[model samples]
Target: MSGARQFTDRADAGDRLGETLRDRGVDADIVLAIPRGGLPLGRAVADALEAPLDVVVAKKIGAPGNPEYAVGAVASDGSVWRNERAIGGTRTDEGYFEERRKIEAENARRKAERYRGGRPAPDLAGKTVVVVDDGVATGSTLRACLSKLERSDADRIVLAVPVGPPGTIADLEAQVDEVVCLETPAGFRGVGQFYANFTQVSDEEAMAYLER
Candidate 1:
């Protein structure tokens, strides 16, 4: 077979992703990594591409009764991507939706500010933007992030990740110019399955990645 074909960790996954992007002649003006888990991979990708590293934050709007189950997501600038299927199926009430939207939007804004650390947000206009995330599961948050980038007028948006299911990747392809994913295997589990050292990244640890 062709080796293990799985990542040792987020950093290893990012190294492979960076190599893939480079081999494909992908060029980017900036690399925007989704905060928390994506920061490590984002740092590696930015270093590989010789581009500035930045963050794009989005908060999941969880179902009222099920806080972990996302009904939608809102980006830092209040741009939103609703999981209409889930919302209709769950029949989420207007009061819950509005309340969660406001709260999550504010949370996203604060996270964006923290990641930027006084640096003026980069202008995405007329620029090829590379968006990095460790891996996607439900894809709600990533969709919201892409929607925010869409509103910001990024010239071209490329979504890069180490592993995601084929169907998820296909759906994302409609939202971005290119989707660079390393493995799309069958019998998909959580993203953590593809990594060996899938440690929980602390807030301080994540912020440190942005600094470097």
Candidate 2:
């Protein structure tokens, strides 16, 4: 039998993650979630921890012919994380990266506006900040988000994801103060494969969760 269990959805995963964090003494001043996908999970965590929920957006820069192949990713504030191995071997051009960055930058801006509604980003000055995501596959996007958080005045930066591949988790541990992942499989294929009901999360649904 496979070791993997089930999560009804991202929210359920987040709820369990919150409890695990609490047990592990994950005390954060605020929870910033990567938007669209992570917002719902963030909501559950924020509610559990009684912390404010904020939004952070990351857009993946996929290689040509393989949209799922994230060679790199960019955060809302223009921080970029590239997989060196992917970049060195792939046929991706500088022009492709530039073009993708332009499109992703605009997409990030639009998401920020829609999600935050002109509200200023949370003041992380000297406060512990936990960045939550549903799961991570390539680790490019999570690295981008963590890189941007490092620039902030946060006292601590914790990356909380429900599931990830074992190798990805090890790499992430070298970057963040703490990495909270529920499952790390050696034969991990993708994040959705671990979930029972892994469905696309619409921006409207994300906003609705934030509104409440």
Candidate 3:
């Protein structure tokens, strides 16, 4: 994929991604998207693959004083993925990290519960689980979601996305059984850069995708 190329929206990207997966003969028992941006794409992928859609939630652990910058991320199940370089660069101590981790983990748990609404988590045992996302920049939260999946009984784990930076996508590839990224663009600044309509997805809209 060209670094200069852009997607029309999440739906267009999802359609293309689903076609790519089919072309590669990839099969999925379930599609787990990282919400809330991921849900839109996951819906298309789920329809294309004729699989069920669900969410995997995670919360970013921001750097000290810079809440927008992620030092790490924690999944709903307490699985964590830390950016050691970010932590060291920010001079964040263990105490701060632990405190933030606990807080953010609980946040993630609540969000997941809210999204699922009273439904139980899907069983992944002996199943092919394809994890979807809109796009990845630093991939802190996505990594945390992958960490949680790694601890599951899934027979296979695949990461799918519309776009990502080369380095970040490459790093994520090592963590999954297979990766189906449509674009690994050069000079990547952020995930929204590759999309024409990158509006923020509300919790209500995100949850509706699962209901479909």
Q: How many pairs collide in each candidate, listed in order?
A: 0, 0, 0
- Model 1 Cα displacement at 20 (Å)? 0.3
Estimate candidate 3's alpha-carbon lDDT, on a 0 to 1 scale: 0.92
**Residue 162 lDDT, candidate 2, scale 0-100:** 93
The segments of candidate 2 whose C-alpha lies over 4 angstroms from its true place after superposition are: none
Candidate 3: where are CA atoms >4 Å away? 1-5
RMSD of each: 1.7, 1.7, 1.1
What TM-score number comes out for model 1?
0.96
Candidate closest to the true structure, highest TM-score = 3
TM-score of 3: 0.97
**Residue pairs in clash, model 2:** none
Candidate 1 ranges with C-alpha deviation above 4 Å = 1-5
Better of 1 and 3 by lDDT: 3
Give the least accurate 10-residue stretch of model 1, judged by summed lDDT.
1-10
Error of model 2, residue 173, in angstroms: 0.9
